[model samples]
Target: MPHTKTSDEVRIAYQVRGDGPPLVLLAGQANDHHWWDGVRDDFTASRSTITIDYRGTGESDKPHQPYSTERFADDVVAVLDELAVDRTDVYGTSMGGRVAQCLALHHSHRLRALVLGCTSPGGQHGIERSSEVRRSLVQPNPVDARQALLQLMYTPAWLATHPGPYYTLGDQSMPTYARRGHLVASNRHDAWDALPAILAPTLVLHGTEDLLNPTANAPLLAARIPGARLELIQGARHTYFEERRDLASPLVLEFLDQKVPLQ
Candidate 1:
């Protein structure tokens, strides 16, 4: 229930947990802070975790206007500023990864390291989904929207293990207005060219079977960034964190704790 009122006057809801260096978690399209629920325990064991609801999502204030990725990035900066956190590790997924990339390019000093998961460089012409899946997301029902999203985020193997959690989380956190705003924001995002400017010690995690964003994005990101490392989670999809936590968590912890350049 904790919130930060940004300079732009948006009330951003966030949750901070655990103890140690701060790790901010950024959720993707139509997702709220709860998107990191499955990985919270794993992360909190070694570091403090900050999960936020982007403007127009979850408990955050939703303003009626055009949305841009830069605005969302600013929203994140505002959250960190409000918390008085000088610098911290950032973990971003899908659209959240785009925001992270923007932050690294625009606000490099605020980050200790970066973790980009199941995301893509936005400027490219990426994978296209079937019409059915696209239509279901824009529908009014959060449950249906979540089901459609999960189908895109996770592989068949993952869906087999986790069936109902995605829908329940969506129903609890996703709202129709927020979803529309996120879609609008997503359409406006473009970060492919900016990847070269990111200086943070970066870790790019992608699912080999990710349908929404192709796995090629991992190599593209790793190649562009000065020293970014890429890890492909085998048999995993966009939602690899939930599907292969056993494999993903250890790798992330090691990368954030070890690979990041120390200031």
Candidate 2:
């Protein structure tokens, strides 16, 4: 796994693939780079994709204290600096979306466009996970966590057709120790007040049937960010990318292509 050392001296792991305009992907809470596997080829086919494991997830170094959205956002900046990418498109889901929003507010010059999937503006608009789900995430057994997460992440139709891949992804992803810290970090994040400061062209994608993070937050995000558009994937759940990649990928690619324009 490729690794980059942040200013804080934390080693972050990431993978850069394909060849086209750079598009950095940020995974959601409790997920690693593997979260993008189902849709990576779709994006990478026409865009350079960089998938990263956040500070306390996947192969990245897991630190015990000082876990904040601002710090994670800095990690994204560190990755971009290491890659020498002046400006690029950003795609983030769930907790990653929060980081993307933070990036726009704090590092607007680094982004050409932003895509947020199954995410929220944080603070009051973001849905809090049920106590049961919260408990499972904090405990973090790969198998138990996978099963528990699947219920909250995927719709019934997706669970039926792609059980194998979903299971495989869960098995390969979800680091026990790292995920625990990530879950704790995510619970503390609230960005509702900061949405209006984001200046990049923004797209918010949500699943209509999403249980984990309600779709109701999409319009709120769109209304806040200037020129931000909202799209709701019908019958989709939290894992909209994995479940409806055909629908989600094309929309995302088109949006990025239109706003950022690959060279």
Candidate 3:
């Protein structure tokens, strides 16, 4: 519920919980801080957790203007500044991973370790979701599109066990322009050329069965970021960190535990 102001004066909302070394949790496209609900306790048990709502989502001020991953990274830095957190580990999912890429690139000194989950680097080199999968989410009926998204997010078994009327992480009632801005920013992310320059020790985590950001992109990210480690969660989909946290959280926590020589 705390807030900070970006250089451009947009109010960014964030929450800090627990105690110890700081770990920042970045949410995916259209989602807010609540996106990390499933696995937050794992990290917070040993590290302080900082969850942020990017400029256009959650309780943050949403200006009807262009949004870029680089700008979102800056918004994150502003929150860290407000809290006097000089360096911290980062774990980002989906579009949040793109913003994390920008953070590692543009603010390398501010990071300790980085974790990227179920995301792509964007541009021509990255593997995109199949046309069939993409089309499923853009259906004419909003209800149908949401159902398609639910399918992509989890396996049929999980969905069968958890009945819906449940909404996704991001509020559906958000301004249409904010959603469009998030989409454009995510589409335009291209950190391939600059990835090797990243100083933080990094981990790339992806779902083996992710339909949104195809799993193949995981290796590309691991190969590009210097000394980055990759882990693929089997039988998992786009929100695997939530759906398969038993497999994913331990990997993230163990990676975060290893010491990296300070920059």
Candidate 4:
């Protein structure tokens, strides 16, 4: 694992693997780079893949300070600056998607393409998860909470065969404050008005069955960004890119490879 220091001096950990065109993979809330374990190789087969452990997870230094998606995006920019990557495509899911939005908005020069999955713009403009889904996520027992999260992230059939826990549980070792910071940052994300200004070719993907961020946000995201495209995977859940990467990865690759007229 390689590391870079942000302007704030927090050490952010990142990994670069394989070769060819670059693609940065951003992790979801409280999750580390391993969140992409199931689909990383797919992208890496043809493109150099860069994965970053946001300031509060994996091997990164976690400081007890406020976190915002914009700040998280800056952490990514620091990593790219350290690696000498001038521009690359990006794929982000859940909280990672929120961070990606900020990255595209704040550092437009650093991206060639963008893919956002199962995430919202936050604030009052985005569609929130249902109250029932929200309650299930906060169960006192870790076991119950993990199970509930799995249910929301994958289909019943997928969970039936893969009973073992995946990356959906996030970093169990993450500090309480770091977790809280991630939650607050995600809750405050409001890129609705700014999305239209994005110049990179963008793709918004969501599972039709996604209950966490809700599938509606995908189309909303696509519509908000000028000339962005939306794709909904049928029968999949929040982590559709992971659970059905077989179907989703190709869409991402195709979109990244296509040349869209500059907006």
Candidate 5:
């Protein structure tokens, strides 16, 4: 229920779990701090996991203006500043990853390691969402929208075995205006040219079966960031980290703990 104010005066809500070295978690569009609920336990077991709602979502201020990933990145730094965390590991997925890219470029001083999950560098370099998937993302009906999104984010085989729990949670209260703002921010995010500026040890994790962000984005992102390591989850989709956090958390833990090679 705590909040931090950005330079632009937007208040972002954040939550901290567990206790250890800091680990900031950025959520995707329309998601707040609770978006990481699926993996919080895993991440918190070894790290002080921090998750925040981007402006215009969850408990954060909903400013009615075109949003950009850069601003979202600044919000992350703002939260870290409020907590007096000089530097810590940061991980982001989807829109959150786009924001993390901005953070690495503009606020590298606050990060020890960077993890980008199922994300892209935007501006044509990112993956293209299929028309159906795109429509599903913006579907007006909440239930129908969630169902549609689940289909795209999880493979049919995975969905068959895992049902209810994975589908029951989210920020759910995201307003239409806020959703549009995040969509605008996501579309405007273009960090490809600036990726080389990231000095933090970086890891780009993607799923072999991702549809929304696409598997092709992994290599492109890894190659652009200086010495970024790319790891692929076989048969996984956009929500791989959530669906298989049990399998994916170790990879993140090792990377953040510096047990694995950055290359």
Candidate 6:
């Protein structure tokens, strides 16, 4: 149980794998570090991958205080600092992408590259999840939540073909208050104005069928962030990186491996 203390003194539990350049994997609103279990091997084959539990998720602290993306971004920076890593590539999905945006804007020097997946800049400028998807998450039981996620976060073919993985992806060990804190914090995130300040070379990937963070957000994010590229995975939903790893992983690896022109 490797842990790091943030500036705020919150304990952040994290895991590291492989032994090349560092790559951090940031989990989403409803997930902890364990959420990366499904795809950690894909990146660990080359890069030194790091995945951490958000303050209110997994093994991190939950103090009942208000949460913000800035706070989460700081935690990421603290994790890197604790590991004595000056900079590293980051792959952030959903809510974690919002945190990544904050990091890239505020801690530009600490990033080698960035990959934003299934995320948005927020406000009316970016599209949102469907009402059906939204409604399903409110106070739903685990069984219901799993079913809804499988329907909205994954394509029918992937869900049908990968039942085992699909079921395992539903694991969420965080408490209700903590999960609610993440939701509240994520809802308040609005980084549209901050996009232009992200100096890190970036790749914006989105699933065409992602109802959580609509596909339109991808191109919008890319256009706003200078030098950012966009790629839309066909028929993929929110969890495309896992549900459609065969397609998503290659793009991520290629992007991570390529050299970013000096600024």
lDDT of each: 0.80, 0.81, 0.89, 0.90, 0.84, 0.84
Clashes (backbone N, CA, C under 3 Å), per candidate, total 0, 0, 0, 0, 0, 0
Candidate 1 stretches with Cα past 4 Å from truth are 125-148, 167-175, 261-263
Residue ranges of candidate 4 with Cα displaced over 4 Å: 260-263
TM-score of each model, in listed order = 0.89, 0.90, 0.96, 0.97, 0.92, 0.93
Q: Every model's Cα RMSD, please? A: 2.7, 2.6, 1.8, 2.0, 2.7, 2.3
In angstroms, give how far residue 201 of model 6 lies from its true place: 0.7
lDDT of 5 by residue, 105-180 (tens): 9988888899999999999777777887788767889789888778768888878987656622345687788887
TM-score of 3: 0.96
RMSD of model 3 against the true structure: 1.8
> Residue 203 of candidate 4: its Cα lDDT?
92
What TM-score number comes out for model 4? 0.97
Off by over 4 Å in 6: 139-142, 165-171, 260-263
RMSD of 2: 2.6
User: Clashing pairs in model 1?
Assistant: none
Clash count in backbone of candidate 1: 0
Clashing pairs in 3: none
lDDT of 3 at 123: 93
Ranking by TM-score: 4, 3, 6, 5, 2, 1
Quote the positional error of residue 136 for candidate 1 in Å. Answer: 6.9
